[model samples]
Target: MSETARPAGRVDTNMAHPARRYNYWLGGKDNFAADRASGDQVAAVFPTVRRAARENRAFLQRAVGFLAREAGIRQFLDIGTGLPTVDNTHDVAQRIAPQSRIVYVDNDPLVMAHARALLTSSAEGASVYIERDLRDPGSILEAPELHATLDLRQPVGLTLLAILHFVRDFEDPYGVVARLVDAMPSGSYVVMSHGTYDGVPAETVTKLEEANAASGGLSRPRSRTEFTRFLDGLELVEPGVVPIGDWRPSPGTRPPEPADICMYGAVARIP
Candidate 1:
């Protein structure tokens, strides 16, 4: 498939976006100075923010590898895909199974500018990007790009890592997740990671919340129980709902303490 055209829109370099800030945390040069400042502020309050970002990305690699190699899933629908990073969903999946197809969804204009990198697929596989928000599942499920690249009848690996926390409770995050999950076939998998204040100090939590508010983003860190609610009716994989660093860590990598990462991760299969 040809590369997707650069989307049209003026990037707001003044306001810090989660995708851009995350890119900064990951040591990427795709972020603006505003993003760096906002990231620094958050990191000042939560010094482990950078570590959590890296560990979360590692979790994504493991989960995608499992879905493509062990579960035999050839199609992927990765929502809230941040700025293109190393070992993206398609990269990991296609390495295991060259025939894997992937659809990346994100509303960030900067991400859209770099969508071509995400669209680069293996000789036998395909990848596409959709400029859309997580709140509108209907638009995502019904997108022509999604239909052209993926078969809804087959199993799809749905990835939502470190993105749902931005969806506030008022937006009905559960309903959004359910709509997307319900659209997938029975054998489909849901790989997810969410921010949590479970073990963190109340003062730190408050400061992090303040940082998010200052950045003009809404983030609601949920508990383990609340996070598990998103996986309702699905069968969890082994080592269920553990910290991101503990979810099948790569060889020679030491899992960080739960308080260090402060993010929960799990992979579940639709029965």
Candidate 2:
């Protein structure tokens, strides 16, 4: 497959984007000074921010592997795909099923740039990147590459990992998810991880909120109950929504404490 063309958007290094800041948290060199500054500001308040990022990323990898290996899913639609990192959706899924097809969507042009260069597919699989906002699910679903690569009539694993919080309340994050889920077939699955203030003390939550505001203030952490609402009407997998590290933890790995992780993760079927 040919590399995707550079997406049509200006790379604003002066402003910190969630994708770049997340890259900084993951200790990647793709971020700018502003992203590192914003990441530092959040880390100053929430000391375990990097841990949360790592655990969230691990959850995504595990969930993708489960979808491909256990759930019998051969296609994936990963929205809010940040900077290409280790064990991305395609990497995990294709390892289990080389024929798996994946469509990655993100608003960050820098992410799309890296994806075009780094996210290659195996000879038996396909990986396509589309620069589209999560808020606009329609555009992503309607992208020509998506239709060309995936068959919506078949079961697809829709992974929305650590992205919904960036869609503010006014943006109708639930609506965005509903639109995407509604488009999938009955056997499709939705895998998600979201930031939360569930177990944190009131003071710590206040401090974290302040630190986020001090930065770009692009994210809105939702409560566990609120996050669970994204899976309403769907059949949740075993153990339901729990701290990101607690969801089907890999053997021999010590799961992080719920208090430190501060993120909820779950996988559910569309039926």
Candidate 3:
């Protein structure tokens, strides 16, 4: 496993981090009491939240596989990578193309402590982790570690799964996405999955919103139109933006109802 300069920061067990809360939802034990409290608060209102997390994760794995196997991509930039579990970006990509290189970016210090786990790359490929906020695209792009692992001159598969919703409008989510996309080459592609309330009932959406606010959670589900704006000029791949599970599901597999997942996923070519 290889890594760049490790950024120093304390893990605040008193407050919940999106990454740790997500870990808790995924049934991982690397979370603290605050994360559990926050996760349970949302789960109480939206009972299918755990399923949503799983569906989002499944979409990520599928997208990575498609990028490496079908799209012939050999480089990946996975932003907002939560605590690693299974089928990580490198795992899926390297399985198809062993020379695939991956650069994972996450702001959580706890994720950095666990970077070694994510950095286990196939001997023919490379993987590196960077502790940097997605809000600051410039910093992440300028980091020496990124250039060392990936060649910006080549196409890259940028995956932003289930993370942008936390980037509130005030944080300039559009700007963050645009800056990252602008840095990639024309043939590059972007895979994104975002939380939404489109198929959910108005009453349930209201309750979920209140629950998140009460728990001090940062989740901000966006509407389809709003989320579509993030891909303004990109060419969307077939099976365009749809419910998380609707995107290229494995043959004969049954997908959850859009209301059950309440998330949208898509992949678009940079051209």
Candidate 1, residues 186-263, lDDT tens digits: the string is 999999999999999989988888888888865788999999999999999998999998899889988999998999
What lDDT tens digits, residue by residue, belong to model 3 across residues 152-192?
99999999999999998999999999999999998999999
**After superposition, which runs of candidate 3 have C-alpha atoms over 4 Å from their true positions?**
1-8
Point out the higher-scoring one by TM-score: 1 or 2.
2
Q: Rate the local accuracy (lDDT) of all candidates.
A: 0.91, 0.92, 0.91
TM of each candidate vs. truth: 0.95, 0.96, 0.96
Residue 173, candidate 2: C-alpha displacement in angstroms? 0.6
RMSD, one per candidate, in order: 2.5, 2.2, 2.1
Q: What is the lDDT of residue 13 in candidate 2?
A: 89
| Superposed model 1: Cα runs more than 4 Å off | 1-8, 117-119
- Kindly give the number of clashing pairs for every candidate: 0, 0, 0
Instruction: Compute the lDDT of residue 238 as modeled in candidate 2.
Output: 88
Kindly give the stretch of ten consecutive residues in candidate 1 with the minimal lDDT sum: 1-10
